[model samples]
Target: MPFERVRLERVRLEPWKRRPELAALALLLGLLMMLHSHIPNIAGVGSLVESLLPWFGVYVPVLLAGALWRRSPSAVVALVLPVTVWLSLFGGLLTDKSHPGGDLTVVSHNVGAGNSDPSGTARQLALSGADLVALEELTDQARGTYEKGLAKAYPYHEVRGTVGLWSRLPLSDTRPVDVVQGDVGPLARTKPPESAAEAAAEVRALRTTVATEHGPLAVYVAHLGSVRVMPSQGFWTDSRDFGARALTKAVAAEPNQRMLLLGDLNGTTDDRAFHGLTSRLTSAQETAGNGFGFTWPAAFPIARIDQILVRGVRARSSWVLPETGSDHLPVGARVSW
Candidate 1:
């Protein structure tokens, strides 16, 4: 009886303590994924990894489920490593936080170049009661529609090439910024030009001073050149990177302390290429929003290319409005000094 009891105690087994190697491998992969930004951009692969960096967090859930199914104590324990790392990186963004009130209300939208109803989009934005509105991808034919629609609400506005800014307050010293320096228009601009005029034609960025009740706020409205992933060329970001660098320089050279940058940057802040802009500006959504606040492809939004970033001010709240006629939804933010 004593020998049988001792053998039973020594041979006791559980399903949960079966596999440890699987869990360790999963955590190790997760750790590498967490440090994706530190990875090199060999043949532009690093930048590509950075672009999809945030999505890597999804792997944690998969690993979690596997760990539970295998019921391995070591594997479950290893999962803590990736879980902690993911939370440390993106934990702040997952929470819904906000301040009480704000002084200024601003909105930004891409409004889709092929949008069938530009006037309707403008009307929808005007109804939002925003003090300032910024629109990108403004086509030549649809520009008039937006201007006429928003004229009564936003009397002071400026348009340069495909981007425009409309404000209820007075706007002054408006100038086109050459985010993409070339003669070819943005629609035709895929690569750098050989003998194009400096900061001429196809301007995708504009800067102006807005006289608000709080003070003068320097506003920059931009539609940075779009990027793509081609089968032959790989991850295409040459134009967007060029534009981001130029815009960063322009913003740094700015004399004003308070600034607001509204645009469809065509890339997320997670991407390393946007360091120039993200370093200088703070995202309103990350500061005060309920969820991910994705604003592209209104039908089934994925990423937040359209953004409202502020500096020298505090954002009390930020939210993405309901879907409009355009492909992208409108994004709004409330800010105060």
Candidate 2:
């Protein structure tokens, strides 16, 4: 009887001693999150991985379940590595950071060009109570609708190419920004003698100075090139990364001290491609928002591709607005000089 009992105890202990592969995988996940920046951008896959990096946390529960089912003590102990790493990376975002009032409220929305109801989207934006609004992906037919719909609340507005800015205050020094990767600024930004349709095709970014009571606030509106993923091409970020590099140069050369960039940057702040932008400007959502504040795919947001970055102002609060006809959701930020 004693020998049989000893054999049964050993059989039960076998599982705790096995499944080293599970423990190894847990450690690998930790390393991936901890040293994600070190991963090369080979074929832009790194950017894609980093873009959805937050979702990596989902694996924690998955692995935990496996560990429990397998009765592997090593795997259970290994889970602490990934859990700690994930919390360290995004733990701050799990908390609320918003404060009360602000000097100005700004909203950025990439109203999809395929939108069926531009007028309705415009009406919703007008009701957002934003002092300034930046819009992207505006089609020629819908441009007039937005202009007319927002005329009452926003007296000053500028439309250059597909991007536009509407402000309750006065606007000046407004011009298109040539965000073509290697294109020279002076030549690229110039609206040459071309048809309105040609201008719309060529321009996707703009900058303007809003005359506020406190002082002049330089605002930049941009819709960087889109990204795509394919089985053959993997993460195709060539155009978007090109635009990012060019936009970084433009932001570096900006003379205004109080500057803000509002747009659909096509990637997250964690993306290495936007290191230049993130290094200089701070994201309002990350600074003062309630949560991850994902603003893409209005039906079910999963990532925060849209951004409101400030250089010389304080972001008091940030939030995502109610969905409109557009595919992308509108993001708002409250700021003070």
- Largest TM-score belongs to which candidate? 2
State the displacement of the C-alpha of residue 150, model 1, in Å, after optimal TM-score superposition: 0.8
In model 1, the clashing pairs are 16-71
Steric clash count of candidate 2: 0
**Model 2: lowest-lDDT 10 consecutive positions:** 181-190
CA shift at 317, candidate 2, in angstroms? Answer: 0.6
lDDT of 1 by residue, 1-337 (tens): 6999888876665445757676777778677777777887655677777766667778777877877777767777777787777777778878888777899999999989889878788889999999999999888789999999999999999988888999999999999998876423234556654454423447889999999888899999999877777666677777888888999999989889899999999877877888988999999998888777887779998788888988998889999998878888889999999
lDDT measured at residue 88 in model 2 versus the true structure, 0 to 100? 91
Q: Candidate 1: where is the Cα deviation over 4 Å?
A: 1-21, 182-201
Clashes in each model (backbone N, CA, C under 3 Å)? 1, 0
What lDDT does each candidate get?
A: 0.84, 0.90
Judge candidate 2 at residue 28 and give its lDDT: 96
Against the true structure, what is each candidate's TM-score? 0.88, 0.91
Superposition TM-score, candidate 2 onto the true structure: 0.91
